[model samples]
Target: MSTFQTPQYTIVELLNKAQCGELQLPDFQRPYRWDDERIRSLLVTILRGHPMGVIMTLKTGGHNVRFKPRPITGIGHEGLKEPELLLLDGQQRTTSMVQALTGDGVVDTEDARHHKLRRRYFVDVVKALGDVREQEDAVVSLPDSGIVTGNIGRDVVLDVTTEEKQHAAGLMPATVLFDSARCFAWMMGYQQGAPERMAVTQQFLSTVAQSVQTYKVPAIELDKDISKDAVATVFEKVNTGGLRLDVFELLTATFAGDGAYFKETGEDFRLAEDWARTEEVLHKHPVLKEMRSTDFLMAVSVLITLSKRRTALAAGKTGKQVPQTSARREDILSMSLDDYRTWAPQLRDALPRVARHLRDLHIHESRGIPYSSQVVSLMIVTTLLGERAEEHAVRARLNQWFWCGVLGELYGSTITTQLAKDAEQLPDWSLAKSSTTPEAIIRASFAESRLGSLRSRQSAAYKGVYALIMAQQTPVKDWMLDQKLDFQSYDELQVDIHHVFPKKWCEDNAIEYWRRESIINKTPLAKKTNIRLRGDSPAVYIDRLDAKGLSAEQVDAQIATHAIDPAFLRAGDFDGYFQDRRRRLVDLIESAMGKSVVRDWNVDSESTDAPANFNEPAASTGGVSIGGEPTPDRTL
Candidate 1:
């Protein structure tokens, strides 16, 4: 069967349908955004009998496709009514025409600069009939007051605030264009007021005004039996608005169309409001603050699909008959409100537990998280594990899989397919339900050579190394204060990643840039301590720390906590410190990833030699600062 039909609708017919609550917009449609200039151009097109464009709509009352319907922007009706059609495209054009050609003719639009405006459109009777090229100039947009003023509102340049003034000036109100009775009465008043130009008024009425009154607009209407996904795909392709509609928006519309939900709640279920409340709850935990609405929906999808797969197995379905567990877009779009209700609260509780797990790994803030995308799989796996997630053995296995994803840099690209795999396998492996290792762990491999390129937080492994060092079994400590860097001090003292050997010292001593700025040379430090060590050598700073209060032994102990070789640091031996710290960082990564990093000690020799001056322009290398002072070739 044909899924759609191309039909023609007149401007008056569409406007009348809008006025009587027959034609409406789907809830997912963006609001009218046509500015004053565009509205004027549309009016000019109608007056000149030019085809504006085609509009696309969906027939309502389809069993398969249901979206909450809303009235056109300027339309007002006494009570809600079931709309026969829902506009999917050409919203801006339809809204502009309805406001300018019907009702009060005062369009609630914006200026070219996007400033709000309330305007009424009119056509000069004589000019509209003069030259086709001058049709645009004939269209006038005035303020809602129907007055144009000059000289700081002291002089009235033009006034059409009353019907008498409109008739005397021979200006035809666009509001009367679509209504025959109103158009006839206005013409009669204009002829009575200007008997000398009676012939001109009649000619204007017959030619110019008549063109606008009988404008035909092309419309393509989708059949009522089209699927929701088909409607979404067609709407995105035809919608002139630039923003692409997402699955959340489609589901929000579908959920609102649930007549049962409205009957019970006495109002439409607002998914946006529910998401805002979810954010309020999740924000209480810093590690979970980065969770997006789509991420939550994906987690719910994983849970629902997993249940479906298990149900299929229980029903003795085999092979292709069983549903594959999925968090894909198609699966998420098919989710019912009942599915969300079943799993949303469980996933919400599981997310905070995920945050605690991340805190245990010393990822104290959302910014420190290596891959925020991995959090979804973790939430689902943790929820499936239930109380067993707290057990040491289960957590150990979960931590291994997480670090494999991070240090392996697997979650940096498209991850939906891998996420589904982990959602299905990780919990089963953790519970000993299956002996097969999760694909994330099996695919995980880290090379020793990646350390040279791991200069910025932009790399997931760099962040993973930082977190591992801070989260070492023996707590790390700040250089000056000798305070233990736990969760409390991590936040209270305002810690951040900073260079160890100091960029100034490296440049002064002619160390290679790659080795100098590498993640192996950085560690988390208190903000005040970083300020104190600005552009100074480690040897210089260690003595200053000693002079402040701490003995040499205490300073060395604090330095050792960060996996640094204190003797190499105290001797100002860059080569020895870099090599020793590299091995130590690799060990920490291996312990977390549950795999050995391939050693390529000569990888640094394969790179270009450092420039003789070891100094480059700040822009060539990402510009950096120490205590907010710019230095050449410095990187954070």
Candidate 2:
């Protein structure tokens, strides 16, 4: 069946329906924003009998698509009920027409600067009758008071406040154009007062006023059987000048229109209020704040799909007859309120658990999260597992899948597909219900050369390596503060990623730029500790630490916690330190991914062709260097 029908309605019919509450705007439609000039131009277009554009609407009685209905702005008829048709597009144009052409001719609109204005429209009958081309200039907008003033209201330039004054000034109120009785009465008054201009007034009434009364606006009425997603999609396509409505906005209107929910609960369902409360809960856990409303809705969709699949299987449906689990956009759009109710609390509870799991991996904050997208899958899989997610063996498997996704960079794109797969597979795989490895783990691969290009903390792999280093069997510690790199100290000490081998020292020694800036050469350190490094060589820094009353052995032990070779750092051997640390990092990644990394020992030599600057002067700064820029002592 065709989804819509193109029907034409006269301007009189559209306005009458709107005033009587038969035609209304959907809640998803944005408020009217047409300025005074635009409204005047629209009046001119109607007077000229020109095609403004098509208006799109949806039949409102359907069980499938329901949006809360609101009267067009400036409409205040008592007991306004549910509309028969919900205006989807042409809201601005239709609203401007309704306000200007009906209900006392007063329009609540804005000026060019978006200043609020209450205005009444009029047609200068003299100018309108003069020339056909001058019809547009005939429309005029005045303040609601129907008086024009100059010099800050001290001078009254024009006053059409009464019917006699309007007739004398040759101004025809636009509000009377749609009402034949009012239009005829205004014409009789104008003709009786000025017998000499009777021919011009009759011509103006027969032409401009007649055109407005008979104007036919094209409308596309969507069938009541169309789906909610289709309505949202169609609204977006037609309303291109407006903001695009997302799934949450669509659901907000859908839930608000749910009469069944209102019957049961005796109150409206507000998705935004619920989300705001959920957001408050999320803010309590810093890492979980990364989960957005869309992500939460996607998780709910996945659980609902999985629930349907389970029910179908239990009813003996098999193979092609069974529903496929999905978290795709279509599935999210089709999800019901009951489905959300069934899983929302569990998913909300599961996110905090996800945050705890991240903390266990030494990822204490949102910045440390490698892939925020991965959190949705984790929320779903963890919720499905429940208490078992806290079990040692199950957590180990879950950790492996997560690290594989991060190091492999698989969650950067096509995330919804991956989210569905992990939602369906990870729970079974982690709990030993199936022995097959998840695709994320199977497809995961880390090449040795990526480490050279992993220079910025922006890379997921770079952040992953940092977390893994701190999460090692022996916890990494601050070199100066000697505190374990756990969640408490991580924030309390203001730890940040800093260079292990000072950038200035590396540059002075003519090291390759890529090697000098690589993740392998950086580790998280306390702000105080980084400042004390003072752009000095590792050999010089260690001696300074030893002078602070720390034994060499204790200092070396702290360095070892970060997967570094203490002897190489103490000896200031850049080559040995770089090679040894790279291997150690690869080992940590391998353990986390539960897979072997492809080895490329020669990657350092082949990665870059930029020559070392052996002739550049070695500039010194009193403060530590960060990212190769020197800072003075006070600046630290």
Candidate 3:
């Protein structure tokens, strides 16, 4: 017999098999991570005749191992049976279809704390028509707009058009399209009085169903002789999008076969459960909540390998210490179940300490965290040095390094190689005998051009600037509210990062949009202040504030605290203002660093380069330190 069969299946047929328990997901597949935008995009791709790649499945009895099978979610459960086929790849696209078609959410297998998934997807037939012509159009599961995903149900109208005549074409629930009887009934109810309208709706629905029923997905089935490792290799190679699977995910599936691997504990060890617990631990940390499972796994790799190496060194089994590198793909792929199990606790203990260390450096939240790869280095250094890692001297160097990494944009691009090199220095930094400073490495990587060219809110340097603003204890007061500004309470009230000179004023004066949008012109202001300053020049607003009984000194002090040059406010000297402010800001940065490290922009604006000693250590201002005792169990 041929080892396997390659056959095509329609969307309806796949959903039926899944609902009937014949088609199921493999136990090791990652949880559904598709947001509404992705789901909507998939529908658009399908409707427009785009080739979404084929899904791969394995014959259940063909493999040597009796793998545990899971019924596809979003459809109501049928009695569990031996699954005939197991989905090996395309979980993301497949899960999206199930959710869109059935309006059922798959339980998030990754999040143990919250084992629920609820999302409502819809499709705007009116909108989909413009993009998809009837010459080659089909029905989509959901509408293109107003997609809302969460635990709670939100009532949404699918149609977004505003004309009075299009009222009948309002949002249609995409889930009804999966059922012919329901769809027909809905059409009958919708077009009861108008036969012509009914005919049109019927034609549209029929075309959609026909398209889905005839759409073919190409496939390749593995022969029965294929080994489990081969399945993993093929799975990774086939899913080139990198959205569905990773080393940790593959390992999670690989370890699933090693049932009762922990012989001594009497408790069966499952990689998926352990992975979720690790995520839960990271989620509980105030600074680490923004961390992804992939990031946590990288740290876990360090915790496992480094500790083992340390033990080997202590035993004199190894002649000399080797510099540790960042976690590699091969290291994760070849990880043993036992090693993975032990590393979970170490990660739970070590990573929060890394967060606390970062928090002390005035990185209040994840957005303030310049590069998460810095966590890997922090984990290794703290784990090696123990309590002394949190010493004032040690933290100051780390703080300086953190800023340098941000300003230098060290981890912005080419992250993996840079992380490997940075990780090599941890051993030296951990030892008191060595004179290695992380700041030196950061300085070598630093470039003055990055700081001068910063304009976008998305750039790493922009976040670093915000962190620096908070670090210097700049008095960011809310004059309108008569209260001290608490930057941390950003979630409670919207903090507007508005232009110092109103955009309308800039447009009126025909100023370049890029100059108006520069980081130099951006500052956090209250929504009220932003709205009230509409189209007003800086000079005009300052005068208005003065008219409201605020003295000139008070206005100047507030603006100065925000790093603005008060002299530039005279007649709105935009060019001179930017130059002066940039100079003073660079000065403040050097003063904060306790050295004249940063160079100001020359008049030419093209050659804003730094001094020759850009890599030298700035004079220390007794080092950056903060409150908070280094305790082992810090929770969110």
Instruction: Give the top-scoring candidate (lDDT).
Output: 2
Q: What is the lDDT ranking, best to worst?
A: 2, 1, 3
Higher-scoring candidate on TM-score, 1 or 2 = 1
- What's the TM for model 3? 0.59
Clash counts for all predictions: 0, 0, 8
lDDT (CA) per prediction: 0.81, 0.82, 0.59
On residues 326-439, what C-alpha lDDT tens digit does candidate 3 reach at each position?
A: 465555555566787676676566666786776555565565566666665566566656666777776666666666666665654334445455555654664445676654
* Cα misplacement distance, residue 36 of candidate 3 (Å): 22
Give the per-residue lDDT of model 1 (tens digit) for 1-636. 899999999888998888888999989888788899999998888888889989999999888878998999988757746799999888899989888888788888889788999999988887788777777688988899988999999999999989999987767888886677788778888888457778976887787667767779999999988887787677568764657677778888988887878898799888787778778878888877767677778778889998999999999999998988877777887788778878887887776788789888898887787776687788888888887997898888999999999899787656677778998889878877799999999999987767766776755677899889998889899989879888889988899999998999899988778778889899999998988888888878878888878899998999999999899988878888988998998898898888899886563563423333222212212322111111222110
Candidate 2, position 114, lDDT? 89
CA-only RMSD, every prediction? 5.4, 7.4, 13.3
For 1-636, candidate 2 gives per-residue lDDT tens digits of: 799999999999998889888899877566788899999998888877789999998898898988888899879859776699988888888898888888788888889998999999998888776566788688999999999999998999999999999998888888887777788788888899568978976786787678777889999999988997787678668768777777787888888888989999998788888888778878988877655677778788889999898899999999988887877767887888888878988887787788789999988887678776677788889899998999999999999998999899777555677877897789999999998889989999997667766776756778888888888989899998789989888889999899989999988999887788888899989999999997888989989877777799999999999999899988989989998998999999999898899886573463332333212324434322111222222110
| TM-score for each predicted model, relative to the true structure | 0.92, 0.88, 0.59
